[model samples]
Target: MSLKVKFDELKTLAGTELGTSDWIAVDQDRINTFADATDDHQWIHVDVEKAKTGPFGGTIAHGYLTLALLIPLWTELLDVEGVTTKVNYGLNKVRFPAPVPAGSRIRVTGKLGDVEEVPGNGLQLTADLVIEIENGTKPACIAQPVFRFYA
Candidate 1:
């Protein structure tokens, strides 16, 4: 595990890799639960037998499901100290470059891109996060996630 640092220290890390998260498995159960919650029971995501004959050769997680994992992955990777509140501003850009098949392990590598000071002792951070799949040529997702933290 990496040591936690104060939010101010993050500013010095601009244009550098902040951290990488531990591997997280994208299993069938997780995919099914997401599909159930979102009412997106697409054959490519849920039906293993059908998906085997489909394009991906096996059941794949939904792109949104992979996107949602960024939150937890980011949390596991870093911590912001001395902040009264931290909120997800939104993504500047997001792309699902490749599908993550069931049982595949994935992790996030975050690079601190830009950090700007806002009014009221707040800071806006833009992180370029890449979700890398284990043993896979392509990443599961790539996104520029933004956050606003108030001290």
Candidate 2:
């Protein structure tokens, strides 16, 4: 279920599991677009046929590509209604534990963490995030993303 929280409620929810995002397909097209955008056309990520012989056994999504998807995925999980604006502060930690192969589906699960006040009537929100690959034993990515929300 989608959770809507106000500023105070957000603080209270810290350390609680948020929710999971809808499954998203990491297809060749999306991977190619990311490659073009970031100029990261590594054979293992953009070259499908050739990647069959490479590591991971096939084309895989760029680790950053998967991390970038967290924006939309986060929106699907929770909504902070009283914020005037929200900004991506930065990540505290990140890791890729498993490869996200092309044609695979993935989703993110998050938990609220620390919440601290920032300058100019803003709040810095932190969360522990994990991106899960469908049927995979290990998570594709783990991250702690911090966001600044202003009222």
Candidate 3:
């Protein structure tokens, strides 16, 4: 579903649970691509042979790779309507609480924590996002992502 809140109306959503996203897989290829792009080809992330004896028993996705996935993963959660522009402001807090193995699926649940007016005709929103990995006891990541919506 879509979020019907306008730029100014976002303030009304403070302290509310906004939306939850659909599950997205964290496959080996995607993990490898992230390792390649970031030049962080750690054996645990890229070398299956070496990772077999590693701590996780097999290759585990890089923490940052899972963090980066939040962008596309958020798309399944909700759509914004009636906003002229939306910009990622930054993150407040972020943590990788669990390892994400390749082939695992993940999803995000977002809560609207804060909303404020900016200098221009823009609204700033801070959302607490928790990304859960299927079958994992701990969430893959917990973060507070901020965004600005200009009308």
Candidate 4:
């Protein structure tokens, strides 16, 4: 469930865990679509038959595709209310620790790392986010995402 809080309540939750998001599948169709969108037609991500004999044993989701998922998954964990504008400021310390095989399920867990005041009556929030592959030994991705919320 998402942790809903007004803009002013943000700072108080620093160091708190927002929660884990519902698992979402990273199927071959989804991977193909992402590849098409990004014009990244690497064989490991698009050519399923060839990928079966490749390093990971099967087609795998692109690392950036998994990273892009943070947007929607984040909404499943946090809802900042009463903010006129919310921005995905940027990312920090991003790492793809493991591969996400196509047809696998993935979920995210996030912690509120910090909240700081910024210019223009806004708050800068940093979230330590981890994306885990179902039944996988290591996380698919780890990222520190920064968001800017304007009242």
Candidate 5:
């Protein structure tokens, strides 16, 4: 389900899970484009033939590509109304526990960890985000992302 809340209600939602994002496929085309844009044409991410025999047994997405999908996935899960600005403050920690094979489906689930007030009538939110693959045992990515929202 999607979460819609005012900026002020963030405090009340601390230490709770917001919601999970809709599933998104990680296709070879997407992996290839990410490799092209980032100039990271690693064989495991682009070369289908070579990657088939590679570690993951197929073309896998770049870790950062998986990481970068979090924000848009967040949009599917939650929407914060009554905020003038929202800034991606930074990440405290990030880890890739498993590889995301090309053509696999993945989604993110976010848990609100810490909520604190900042200067200029702003709120800082720390969310523990988990990206899991469809029918996969291990999570593809886990991260703690900090966001700043101004009222």
Candidate 6:
């Protein structure tokens, strides 16, 4: 479930654990679509046959694919009311610690790190996020994403 809050209340939630998103499967079809869009058809990501003999023992989703999934997963975790606009400012840090094999399930958990005022009549939110693969040994991605909510 998402944490629904008003824009003005965001600051009060700093340092709070926002919670985890619902798990989504990273199937080959989605991986192929991302590969097509990004022109990143690396063997380990799309070449299922060859990838079977490659590292990870199967086809894996591209690192960026996992990173991109953060957007939808993030929206599932937080919903801010009373904002004119919401923008994904950018990421401060990102790391892919583990591969997400095709067909694997992934979910994200986040903590509201900081809430500060920005120049454009906006509130800047920094969230520390972790994307974990179900039953995997290590997290699929670790990222610090910044968001801006304008009044």
**Each prediction's TM-score versus the true structure:** 0.94, 0.96, 0.93, 0.98, 0.97, 0.98
Question: What C-alpha RMSD separates each model from the true structure?
Answer: 1.3, 0.9, 1.4, 0.6, 0.9, 0.6
Q: 68-150 in candidate 2: lDDT tens per residue?
A: 99898888888998888989989999999999999999999999899888898888889999999999999999999999888
Better of 5 and 6 by lDDT: 6
Clashes of 3: 0
Better candidate number, 5 or 6, judged by TM-score: 6
Worst 10 residues of 2 by lDDT: 1-10
Would you list the C-alpha lDDT of every candidate in the order shown?
A: 0.91, 0.91, 0.83, 0.96, 0.93, 0.96
Candidate 5 lDDT, 1-151, residue by residue in tens: 6799999898899988877889999999999999999999999999999988888999999999999999889778768899999999999999999999999999999889889999999999899999999999999999999999999
Q: Would you give me the overall lDDT of model 4? A: 0.96
lDDT of 4 by residue, 1-151 (tens): 9999999999999999988999999999999999999999999999989999999999999999999998999999999999999999999889999999999999999999989999998999999999999999999999999999999
Q: Candidate 3 on 12-33: residue-level lDDT in tens? A: 7788875777788888899889
For candidate 5, the lDDT comes to 0.93
Ranking by lDDT: 6, 4, 5, 2, 1, 3
Count of backbone clashes, every candidate in sequence: 0, 0, 0, 0, 0, 0
In lDDT terms, how accurate is model 2?
0.91
Q: Where does candidate 1 clash, by residue pair?
A: none
Instruction: Name every residue pair that clashes in candidate 2.
Output: none
lDDT, residue 25, model 6: 97
